[model samples]
Target: DRCRVTILHFNDVYNIEERPNTEPVGGAARFATAMGKYRDQNPLVFFSGDCLNPSMMSSITKGKQMVPILNSLKVKAAVYGNHDFDFGVDELEDVTMETKFPWLMSNVIDTLTDKPLADGLEKTVITWGTKKIGLIGLVEEEWLVTLATVDKDDLKYLDYVEEGRRLAKELKEEGVDLVIALTHMRWPNDVRLAEQVEEIDLILGGHDHDYDVKKVNGKYIVKSGTEFRNFTKVEVDFIGPKYEISTMKIEVTSAYREDVEMKKIVEEFTSLMSDKTATTLGRIESELDGRFATVRTQESALGNFLTDVMVAATQADLAILNSGTLRSDSVHSAGDFTIKDLLTILPLIDPLVVLEATGTQIIQALENGVSQYPKTEGRFPQVSGIMFGFDPEGPPGSRVDPNSVKVDGEYLVPEKVYRVCTKAYIARGKDGYDVFKDCKPLTDPDEGPILSTVIQNHFTAVDIVKGLKPCRSGHHQSLIHVASVAK
Candidate 1:
């Protein structure tokens, strides 16, 4: 006799609204309805994390808005994504407590607590159908270094392959029928785990937001799509000593009715927000590209627009911003732009600062920026008042071409000092920008203006010039000019 089980998995959801003008307009409401379609199958729900912040709603609530959304899914067990810690460990801990499931962090340990970081469970076991399923969470070392809120010294990261092998062996010895590794990492890392860990039966992964499935070494690695757009439905069948697996990608489209109960919960939080977010600020003549796949891998018009604004507002010679600062993950259409649209693109209150750095340091920073090229890492630079090119296939630290580097239309002189405008996050040396930590700050972070306000003021200035609002002068003219040119 054989047994069967079903699993529903998704990752990297940040918004709860139906993305206007986008197909499969997935929202929490519709996604909940889609999940219920598998109710009779008694499916086990699993999330690969990253639900806590970076959304317009999450920004206002410090991710509190995600609690009910996650709880609605009845997730069995989950792995933590790097963005989950954006608000710090304490906030994540508090948010997790309100949810109705366990989060796993099998490889990373909090040295202070002598336990999994964020108090996550190292492993969990559940009986489904006719067999016991054992689960463990794993992550990559790459993202651990980039977490701004966590102190690297307070935690320890274990190689996923090593941890997956050891943990799977333990689970098999304990008589579980299957061992599943829930991982929040890139595709290469997931493939590595599948190939190296013979005892693990399957890998459910996150971090990169693509719906994909691949088999390596007779094991399957699955990643559901992002933002409630799609989910992966997996089926496992056992026949004697051998088992087989199958998967389906379920799209959450308008064809499905919104789950009433979930819709109410989403509305409850949404109604708390002010209507001011809808106020029209300006019009876009061209679309702005903010998708991670685009901005993190190359220079984008949106990036240029933002960094230009930074340089103008701070009165710096050049500016560099990490691609991660743009979180909307969508292309903004050429039309009316509103406060809500602006917040969706940049939700965090990043303060601007001016740092004086030698041309050598600037080159080093650009090298570090492209170090994670083609992987969509946040360290990638989006710049203004400067231009440079790199070979994507070149060695990480040596990729940036020195001859291509320029500042204010002049080739960069290694010893020449230039004023660089950037957000305070990188100014403090986070996101692999180690060359910036020691740079002299021409303007202290505390004294600098908030990024969103500067952008809004630019719009206000434009509106003033258009005579749509009360006239304002002097301080905002430079930013308005920069923005107009970019537009």
Candidate 2:
């Protein structure tokens, strides 16, 4: 018998509507209509996750606004992305509970219950005609240490490879005709899974935000782009277990026909953000590069400017920031920087904190920050008051040379304590940076101004409203990847 089932997949979506309003793309209401037309293939609308937090709307409602939008699209199930944990466990659990679709997580487990984080997150099976297809979800194990807002004590992340094999074996034993591993990890990790697990037939992935379609080691792999701007339409020919895959991109030049049922819902949510988005702050002449690849992989001008703001806000001797804190990838042209821009980029609601630390602790922290360097992990450090050289070829924990560290134009005193400012997330020792956990607080996080307000205040007061280049000299300098040391 020949059966055809189309799988429609998207990942890392947050905005319900497209930006700029001129040639817009990415409205859930529009996406619903775009997806609704495929009635013949019994399309399974799937997402690879990361929609819930760091979004402008997530700030106001802790990701509650996403419920109606996702429900409108009739999403079958989603694998969790790292940003799914940005709002903390209770809020993530709340959003998980609110959605009509099931959220699947095969590797993420709740410690207290020794099970998947929420009821919606259990593994699922889909009946396609006469065949039963099993779906398994997995997140990168380092999420708990990297970007997750949950307490490390309350969660467990089993390695994805082992968990994937176990889950696939069980599903095959259950007589499912095919197995699809849905995941939100690096593309390389996805390839590793395909290499190890022969029972798995396909992997629809997210997290890198690029459009990729490949046949690796005879297993099919696909990743549609981010912002719901593109998706994969996969047709499975059941007679021979063969497949045809292609990517469909929704351009910004137009909008798809509105899904009338979800029109009012999107409008209402847009109304809630009207006042906030309309409020303008300062202006910039040049584009601020907040792209993940730019900030996470190298010294970005915006990253430097931001860490400088943090140092000023706290009056600390130095400051440290993680690249994941800034989310926007588009360069802001010469125009007003609105409250919306600030909130959109730094949407985690993470508070600033100042702590006292010795030079030895600082060196260890820097080593931890760059351990994932050249790989574009979230732990990459953006700094305000330090300059140092590092050897990327060095092993983990030995990359940063302690003697090369200097603070405020002076060499760091190993015995002397330096006042360092950073986010509450770091102070709590999140992201595998446990050194800050023991540092005594010089300024409480609650007493400090939020990230958005600090930047706004700085721009209005000190920044000249002219075409400007990124301020990466003092804050974001490390001599690696350069042809030679400049100094």
Candidate 3:
């Protein structure tokens, strides 16, 4: 008996629609159109997770905005992701109830009750067909330590390889002909899982934010790039004991038409954001570049502006933030800046947090921040009210020059305390800035203003070169651009 099954997958989706004003490469509406074409096959639409929060709209709707769009797509099941907990367990539970599909998570458990936290989550499943396929969902266990919103006592995540292998073997024992793992984990982790658990026939993964595919032990592993830029389709043809599988990458392009039904749902959410996004937040005197190629590897004017806003808003001695937070991916030419533009640039909804750190701790953070200078790493520090030079060609942790650190025309005193403003992401020690996490908390999360609002206020309040002293110019004299040195 020959039968065909099409497996469609995407992950790390945040924006419910397309890039603010870019191509049709993203958006739930576009994805709906892409999926509609294969609806005849009754394809299994699998999501690897991370969609519950992080986009500008999620801040407003608390992840409710994604439900209708996802419901329209008819997703079969999705795994858990770190970002899914951004809104805390209760809010995530609300979304779980609203979803039309199964939210799978086999490793996440409520320690006190000794069961899954939400009734909405699926433990394991055998999808019925000519060939039965067992499905299991897994998330990286590290979120147990770093996830911010969840109470430490509420939940626990079991090790991925240990739990996943145990579950996959059971599915095999249950007489399922094939087993698949939908995982929200880095590709390397998935590769390791494939090696350790050979029974799992395929792995659909997320979290690296890039388009990737690999074959290990004659099994297909795939991850569609983040934000729905592409979706991977796996066609499996089975005839009795024989089976053939093939994969293709499908781009959601401007050329693709939106499904009318899903388009309405997308547009409804878009309309809610249109006014906020379109309104002019402030003006810029010169072009600010927030391009990833620029900010992640160099001291960017956009980074300077953002850190300057943090300093001004928090009234801290200085502010430091990672360049990776900027997501605009394009230069903002000098002119009016809209709320939408800022949202696209600083996509995360974290609040501005102020912390107290001594000069020694700060220097350690500066060294750690620039450890990945030549390569593009997100921890590249953008600063306000200070200056420093680094030897990028030097070893990773020793790159920053101690003699180079200065504030207000004086060298930083090791014992002196200073107030520093930073994003909650970094303040919580993400991206190699652990010294920041050890610092004394100054601004409480609830009291701190939302970062974008602070930047908007800074622009509205100052509005002139004289008031914007150190931040007036974007160029940093301390360290030369790595690209320039490379040339």
Candidate 4:
């Protein structure tokens, strides 16, 4: 018997509706349009994973809003992304139930029960005509540790390579013809799995958002870039007892029109989001500009404001935060900073923390923070209440001359102790600040509480900077800009 099957895949869609500014890209309607066209010619449509959470739009809706749109597109099956657990296991279970398609997570298990956390559907079997397509889903284990929202006690992520071997063996024993490994793990992990696992015919990937299709260790691996900009279509032609992929095409969704029906669904959701976003609390005195290419490289008025808030919130002598944490540097145009704007800037739910450290540890920590400056490291700290200078041209460790560095007009005393205010992310050694990993925690805050709420309560209002002067002193220069109330 001869059979033909096509697998349509897109990773990291992240709630991008097809229309222009009216909505984000990769909306259900737009994806439906693309899926409908393919389904008309074929019968299978598969999403690799990472279709939910991480966006303000998705979070506000608790992922319920995406179900109808995905159902409309006839998404047969999708693997789970790390963000799927952003709201917690219960919310994720709700999303799985609401979704018309089967949400597969072969690597995620209940730590207490040692059973699959998202189980109800078959883990590794999807049929197309007479051919049996084995589908195995893999989520990154590191997500259990990195994500601020997820509770380690509630969930357990099994090793991808080990899970891959176990599932592949089971699927092959069941007379599966081709094995498709849908993963939320990055390229290196996928490559390692491909090399180790012999039965995996294709590795469909997400997470890193790099667009590339390459064969590693005889396995075909494909990843579409983030935000539904593109998708990969793999056409399999079954010849006798064997199946071979005859045609593989990368379809750019941006080239085609958004599906009309899906567009309507998106428009309705967009209207709801807009109405909700209109409730503004306070106003900015001046425009808060955050053009990333310009401001992030130096310092942003918004960034300074956030650091000041962290300092005040912790009542620490100094504060340090990453510029990358400020997702967008869009200048405020004399308007209310809505809840949406705040979420966009600070997407992660990292809580503020105060740590006791000596002046020497402070300088070491600051050096660790600015160590990767100009390169735009996400953990790069934007300081408050304290100022220091650095020379990128000089040696890495010697970049900050002790003579030039100062805290309130005096050289840093290596022996003196200082109370530092920073996000829990830094204290956990997330941003390459391993020095703080062993440091005693002064405060351990809960997740889900908004930092913006703290800012609103502390400061009456914000006054944006206009034509802020650059801080330069002798051979060293301070990267921070903007002014904020001292703690």
Candidate 5:
């Protein structure tokens, strides 16, 4: 006799409301309605993680809004993405407690508790349609260092291929009919796992924000689109000892009606954001281009403005802010800049830190920033007191021209130490800036100002100077320089 089962998978969702005037207006409400159509198949829903922060709404809620949205999905299992731990392990654990499914972190372990990182399950088995299916979650090691709240030294991470092989073998030995690897990693790593791990019958992945499906070593690797845009519906037919699988990409567009309950849930969380949008920060004379296409590819006016604020706020000789820090993905026209616009540009409360980095380390960091040029990677640098040129055709480690490098209008001196103002994320060696890890923290995160707050303060200083708001005695006058530089 043959048995059939269905699987529903999606990943990297951030916003709950529909993106107005955008194609495939994939709101959580519409996504829920779309998934509801498959209920008759008794599909096992799986999520590849990253629903916790970075969205405009999540910025205010600190990801608390994701609890209800996740619970509504009735997810069977999930793997943790890098952004899931953005709030911290403890906060994630709390969010997990409220969710209805099991989260798996098969490779990462907490040395302090001697358990899976975030206390996630290492493996789980469930019976669906007369077959026993084994699930194991896996992630890449590259992003482990990037988790702001997680200390790499305090945790142990195993290779995904090794862990997938061992776990799938154990599950097969336990009499499971099929094994599936739920992974949060890039395409290459998933392909590597599919090739190396024979015991795993299928793989579902996340973290790349692309909708792709490929078969390697007779196993299928699937990645659903991000932000509730699309989902993968996999059909598995088990015939005695073998199984045949097929997948369909289902897009969530305006054609589908929103589920009332889900829409209400979304409205409840979003209504709280109304009051925070009206307070104007200041007026800009020209459009500040914060779109990813501009900021991640090359220096833009928005990048210069933000980096200028960083250098002014921390009084560092130079500043480097990752393009990823600017997330609005849209341009702000020359007009009244509001708190809403600032929050959209910088949703995360990134604390600034001053690092005493050598000129060599600075060069290394700049090289890393341009390593993935033209690919729109987040590691691209937006700078203020430094300038360097890179050849896109050059190799990654040698892209930046040493001769073009200058700090404070002078050529870089390899032996000289310069105070660099940057997000605490970079100081911890995130986004391929490992050269900064060993550098001394000239100013700790505690002593540094929050990035958004600094921008807001700069505007307040501008208002004070314009006599729009009365100034207090001894108000620092240094911030007014940022307004002038932006002009």
Candidate 6:
């Protein structure tokens, strides 16, 4: 008798509903169609995780929209990603209970009970004909501190390597023929795990949207990037006492047709959401157009306007924000700025925070912000008050000229204290603002709501374009010049 199993996998499908109107890409509908065709030959379908949360479409529906589609397509199992906890454990439980398939999370522990998630844990052993396949799931514990909002006072994160080794030992003792670790973690961490864990035969990974397959210490590690753009299909042929991987194929689902039923469900959900989000707020006198790189590199009319709003909202002496927070770069046409536009541009729930810091600390914070301009960092500050120039070619710490720094039309005074306004993310040292760690908050930390929502409410009827201007000069001039001239 010949035994075979096929594993169909996808990752980071953040509920993109329709086939992209502009670009050729896979949406949930197209993915369902592709999965249907694949299931005809083989039955197993798995997602590495990050299936829900994020995006206006999923948030509005409270993750109800994707449940019907996943059930129709028959996803066997999925590892839970950090984003799944965005709405907290209760909401996650609600979504899982509604899901037709089982949700897996081997690593995520409930702080209250001091145990792993109740829904799925350790491994799920499925006997396919004569072959017994073991599936284990792991979620990155860093999310407990980085992304999750639930009071983590009760939750404690465990060591992945130790837990993984223990779990593999247990599964091996259970007479499992093969082990598959469905890991929702960074690529580097997955690589490390594969090398360290000897019992693990294969790993289906997510997070850090990169697609590639590499073998570490005889273990196969595969990641199928982000946003449902690509999926991996692994065909396994099991011969008694031995196993062979016949084919590991990565397919682009955008080439296929949209799943009709899934598409219909998505359309209905999107329509209902549109009825609520499509209301016209106010007309823009002209287009508020800019890109993250374009606006941050120099001065952006939109950036300036947004920074001004933050300063006004907090009554801070200065304001700073990251251009990366602005997600979309599309040119807005002269028309009403709907809730859709606002949501697209600023999606994260980062609240505004006002802090009082000595002039020396503010300068230190500015230096730290500029230090992040390198390729890997995302928190480089875009300012509204002070100005300075940086030499990208210069080494770190030496990039910005201290002599050139200025605030409020004068050289930065180390002795003076300035009321600074920035997103709560930075105040908490999220995007690399260690200087803010010791700073005192001028206003209560909980006073303001998410800064993105505040901007939307404040500018409900205003033309943001009218207030657009470059916040910083592109020239390598002194901060004194930037403070005096840009203002």
Top candidate on TM-score is 5
RMSD of 1: 13.6
Which residues of candidate 2, in runs, are more than 4 Å off? 21-24, 119-122, 240-255, 274-318, 321-487
Candidate 3 all-Cα RMSD: 12.8
Clashes of each: 0, 0, 0, 9, 0, 6
After TM-score superposition, the amount by which residue 397's alpha carbon in candidate 5 deviates from its true location, in angstroms, is: 24
lDDT digits (tens) for residues 164-219 of candidate 5: 99999999999999898999988889999999999999999998787999999998
Where is model 6 poorest over a 10-residue stretch in terms of lDDT?
471-480
lDDT for 57 in candidate 5 is 70
Model 1 lDDT per residue over 336-368, tens place: 888888888888878677899999999999999
In TM-score terms, candidate 4 sits at: 0.63
In the order shown, the candidates' Cα RMSDs to the true structure are 13.6, 14.4, 12.8, 11.9, 11.7, 12.2
The TM-score values for the models, in the order shown, are 0.64, 0.61, 0.63, 0.63, 0.66, 0.63
For each candidate in the order shown, give its overall lDDT on alpha carbons: 0.83, 0.72, 0.74, 0.65, 0.84, 0.67
Best by lDDT: 5
lDDT of 6 at 24: 39
Model 6 pairs in collision: 111-154, 111-155, 299-470, 299-471, 301-468, 301-469
C-alpha displacement of 29 in model 4, angstroms? 3.8
Q: Evaluate model 6: give its TM-score.
A: 0.63
**True-structure RMSD for candidate 5:** 11.7
